[model samples]
Target: MAERSSTMKTPLNKALAQRRSKRRYSRRSCGEGTYLGYTSGRQTVLKIPTSRKKPKSRDITNQVDPDQVALLVKKEWHLSYVTPLYQFRYTMLKTYSKELSAFLVSEKQQGQTIETGQELCFKVNISVVLGLAETNQDAETIYIQILSKQVFAAKDEAQKVVWSGLLTCINGDVDYLRSLPPEFVSLPLLCTSGPESLSALVKSWLKKTFDCCFGPICITSTNLQWLAALWTGCHPTKNIQYLKLAWTIPTQPPMDVTYKVNPQDVWKLWDSARLDDGAEDSINIEEVNSFIRGLQTHFFRHFRLDLSAGSLMRVSTALGSAHHSGKIKITSPDYMTTVLQLLTECALLKMPI
Candidate 1:
């Protein structure tokens, strides 16, 4: 009976060891579709599936449908890009041909900056019809097609006549210039013949076009007199912010005229207009002085101006009075300083003066 019991104990011990080993290496079914399986590693560890499904490519039709995307109708359009050598086409609609023509002329004239390609679109109250943009690799030319149909019905006859005259000028038909309303007779001068004519053209152009929404005007010509005049004249009435003159040294010196430096103009321009409604004096003494002081401080900090030159020195001297001893002994502004001050003042005042 003892020998039989020993034999059963040996077999029972072996069976229990086998069951324990199988339990140690068994696959564990985790929650959901995932399961942990023991792989080639000797240690009992969970192995996650590494398989990923390959993406399939589906064939789509090559044809493009215009209706599939939003249309560009009745949207305020501006010059997207204009290359120096590019040609422009105006596609007129059946109605409002004059209005469309005027808008086209405005766009073309506005794109006359020396910058090769400019994104200088301003508030002109014009809508785009078909802005056809075509790129030519071999010829290196960009053709801009402005399809100017009846984008918006004119509110009044004034709007119609204003635009029609502008279109006529763009068409190089100056015969309509005299017949146009007296206010817009100057519009025809925008068809610039050469550099000699640009000064007058720019002056007339600014007078006719510079309104509340004109953002920036970059003059590449070396004519500083006209630039200063245009800059001053436009900024007072309109909300023009940017005035950049592309200065190039002319081979021959320009007309021998003394360029005056009037820093008082800056102060006058910077100061906000008084309320005609008879509200209390909005121009606080401390506030106005503080604003001027800040602007002068910033200008001196960024740029080096000779404080000894001309009438500007008077203004510069007065600038110190607002804060410190009100007596800053400085010399006249040098040539470069004068130019810098002119350009800086214009650029700094991004808002209407």
Candidate 2:
């Protein structure tokens, strides 16, 4: 009887193993040749980019206030995607500033006593950042800064800016902007550099005021690859100093690999990857892939491990650094527009119909 029971259990275990193997194969087969596209309640699929133009260095110091530009490039900002703001107008910025200030003050004071010399006071300022819009359909960029001070501070003491945010659309998709109603403004991207609590409070106020929704936008590994290629392509005109990439490999305990390449060597590889007929101003997806492959191949020759098997977690150069978690630091102002355009595309992709 014991021998017969053992025989019966062996066949049952075998059947379960076979079923698991079949499921794994099916999942792999389905992932292949899949044409994934973004849909926003439209029958037509959005044509996402497979390639992008090389970033051209443009001196924006003369275009806007130098002080404002300094403030932007100095901080690493947290990113968010904002839906179309219903009835948002550029004319009422002053009124919006006052209202936002009051809203934040009321929120802070709730269920708390205001003690003399102990309570904090808040001030909000909103202004238009001119000359960022490329097309007429694009809305003028709005800059917001929140200043805070102690309620009993000295009269000569100045309030310090505790938070700052930018709402802008630079070279946005024309069709999507045109499709929106006149009342809706397509400032789809928001970059905030501040405490999480203040960021949440400001977002809440904007949502209540403009009937818009905000969602966190994370930079994906593929986008980081694109950024690495784009920034590397700018090496000729701009000094990238060095190229550094971070990858995470799935191992028993997870492994991290940091690969750093000399700027001159990587530039030569990028230049060689370009076709003879390829325009000097633009780079194709094929060239980008080749550049990356060249790096991975070189590393494999020495390490006997393929870096491509791991996920790219971060990419950094002298000009900027981008992480997969959506935090970015722009050290140079020349390529700010290019970065903002890519971020805008990502934000728009997050929009729900």
Candidate 3:
């Protein structure tokens, strides 16, 4: 059997050798920087040297950090890609900062909200479980009726917010974010639901943007670490480091994702009475605020967070502290006071603005 097998291999080797002898070996083709034409319907190729190619096609550029850019651009991008709202917020800075700082949040009171405040009330809705129930008003209304605080500090502190209100604001943005190709949503902090179709659409966009903005080697083939980070950020649980592993590569043969944040984990975090530490921490407040500032800087920025009056009060504290710390400053204190009043006014109104 061995002799016969060896004899057969000799014929196969001879056949392969004959084929290789007849074929021509060619060098790598300079297919790029070449133009095509036709002569008498016959195709012709005009090879342009690589040096002749347009510089713009080869010369890479980067996007602005997005932090320093005017808010108008951010707001435009948000509306075109993120959301649609009735009124936009215009800030009045009270202090100043080299980077981040105090914005005099100014707006008029929603008189309609105060007038119709009597109409707002909580009522029972649906029974999801044998014991657990969803109030009808709770399910539909954007916010539960709340009174105006005489003081601004009380307004910025986050209290209980209606799920409906969250839905109204985040839902549209979520849908828009989902609808967009992955590239659009691939901005560092902006993550998507862990749906393959969603991420696949945007992944290339992210790769290109980061590559173009940062550098070609910004994301190479071994970007599992990047994906791992994104996976945790997008997962409903808001647990960016949910998958624990030694942050190394190759030697350990970085294993496949073995653990996933469960649905229960997300519910526990998102369905809390107040802001969970995980939620607060998961969201980079400083970064997000910077992005928010970007939104307001140029185009009108509208963010209808449920925090409303009370939450705004606490925000005012940060705005003030950051203001004093040289993190932020307000050029218009009157405007700042007015903006603060307007935010409280909206909260008292329970209006989704």
Best candidate, TM-score-wise?
2
For residues 64-166, write the lDDT of model 1, one tens digit per residue: 1232112212111111111111122233222233443354456547664322122222222322212121111111111112222223435341321111011
The count of backbone overlaps in candidate 2 is 0
Instruction: State the lDDT of candidate 2 residue by residue for 1-353, as single tens digits.
Output: 01000001111111111111110011111112222222111111111212224445677787978887887895899999998899887889999999998988897778433222244678899999887777797888889999888877898899888889999898677787888899899899999998788898899999999999998888867667767877877786788988888888776677788888788777776666655555455544455556677777676656677778888889999989999888998888877876787787677777665
Stretches of candidate 3 off by over 4 Å are 1-214, 217-254, 266-282, 285-353
Higher-TM-score candidate among 2 and 3?
Answer: 2
lDDT, residue 350, model 3: 21
| lDDT, model 2, position 127 | 94
lDDT of 3 by residue, 151-175 (tens): 3335365432111101112111122
Model 2 off-target regions past 4 Å?
A: 1-56, 111-119
**Candidate 3 global TM-score:** 0.14
TM-score of each: 0.18, 0.82, 0.14
> What's the ranking of the predictions by lDDT, best on top?
2, 1, 3
Clashing pairs in 1: 307-330, 307-331, 308-331, 308-332, 309-331, 309-332, 309-333, 321-326
